[model samples]
Target: MRDGTDHGDQMSDVKKGLLPGQLIWLWLTGVVIALDQITKHMVVARFDLYERLEVMPFFNLTLAYNPGAAFSFLADAGGWQRWFFTAIALGASVVILIWLARLTAAEKLQGVALALILGGALGNFYDRLVLGHVVDFLDFYWGNSHFPAFNIADTAITIGAGLILLDMFLGAGNGAEKKEARKKHD
Candidate 1:
């Protein structure tokens, strides 16, 4: 049999410039955005503003809009919030794209976080640009207590942020991994 050089050359041929593993995260991002928009479209078609359809004891489908940040922060502030939030989301999307391009194949956790964030940002950005507000439909409640209505985009962002926090707390970054390796070696 030949030496390992054959395998190295084959790998180099397969990985011209872009890595397949890196692009997989971008595909997941696309799926997230597609799901977010499709669900939002369904909500808009089936529900009117403030209209609620109880889906379960603790959940409902409600159509609502927010022209501001998370939990409707600055939602009441004049129309400037729309542009402000859009700009933020756009900037975030660009940053996430660059970040994703830089991630290595093994940084799956970070990749997932960035993709989720990018997908969510694009989803909301689309609404803000075309509708002047973010469409929210998912409603969770118990008795009289209720959580704010949110859409898939919001869910993605929240989950992405949570994953980022989890990564930080777990010390899964490159520095931490290297530290662990050194400790094991010593």
Candidate 2:
């Protein structure tokens, strides 16, 4: 109804793969994956492992491989962690897809957030499945202290997580307002 369309029409579009439902947000997911993979490929071709090209006072285009989770967690835990993370990413992608498909049209923010997270997860999952590690290139540092290197996928995931938190807080406020309005009506 947001666009003068009914839920039946939305469902028809979904069935036709026209991407008119909340699944329309999957277009963002595809864009993120394409950008993430393209950038990672460019970095891999242009730099050697651990190579750093300073771009600014606090940023660099560096080449890094992470065999573990965020911040290189379990990076040194032999080789099993690679598959473990891959499996998790695969499972999460499936769950996100289903969740995105089930979202009401009103849940636009949540849909976008889930799509971003799904795209990021699949992008990293591809690297883990094929390369045994995730390629990370963007680096940020302050003087001698450097943050962990990450890639476009990580950026998307982080942004998506922030959006979800925002939606949660906003939804809470709206719910409270609705409750107050109901009390006044009663």
Candidate 3:
């Protein structure tokens, strides 16, 4: 006994409170948050602001702070950026959680990507909320040019973004295209 209506009902139930979909990936989010905080705390404890310890020819552990977005985009914007960025992170986190809960089982890659981004957003959100700035310690550079110092949260966010791009090209998008082709044939 099968009915087409049952699938729609199941989807509605999942969308409602009756089912928790793909939230299994939340453990990854927690792990990313924990690691991000721990590393930031360690950098704060071991290094003075602007102090640098050479770890390699092109890499160093440098204590730095950013009160702005990536690359210190608004580091000197008269301090409103902190609250603004924090608000964005909070909103993004909420949206990511809802998106995670609504994901289908087949969207495992998307689930992981969203979880990493959520974790990174919250990790930085904690800093902006409590410290008013993010602690950055990992630095890379060439002979005279130094890249912006960043942290575990930034790294996770970057990797998550890359995964999202990869999925767009190789994952569900392709499956949808295949499904569309099948529909055309039928």
Predicted model with the maximum lDDT: 2
TM-score to native of every candidate shown: 0.82, 0.84, 0.83
In each prediction, how many residue pairs overlap at the backbone (N, C-alpha, C within less than 3 A)?
0, 0, 0
What local lDDT score does residue 109 receive in model 3, on the 0 to 100 scale? 81
Per-residue lDDT over 56-82 for candidate 3, one digit per residue giving the tens place of the 0 to 100 score: 999999999999999999999999999
Model 1 residue pairs with clashes: none
Clashing pairs in 2: none
Candidate order by TM-score, decreasing, is 2, 3, 1
RMSD of each: 9.0, 7.7, 6.6
The runs of at least 3 residues in candidate 2 whose Cα sits more than 4 Å from the true structure, single-residue gaps closed, are 1-19, 175-186
Worst 10 residues of 3 by lDDT: 9-18
Compared with the true structure, model 2 gives a TM-score of 0.84
Q: Which candidate order results from sorting by lDDT in descending order?
A: 2, 3, 1
CA shift of 43, model 1, Å: 0.9
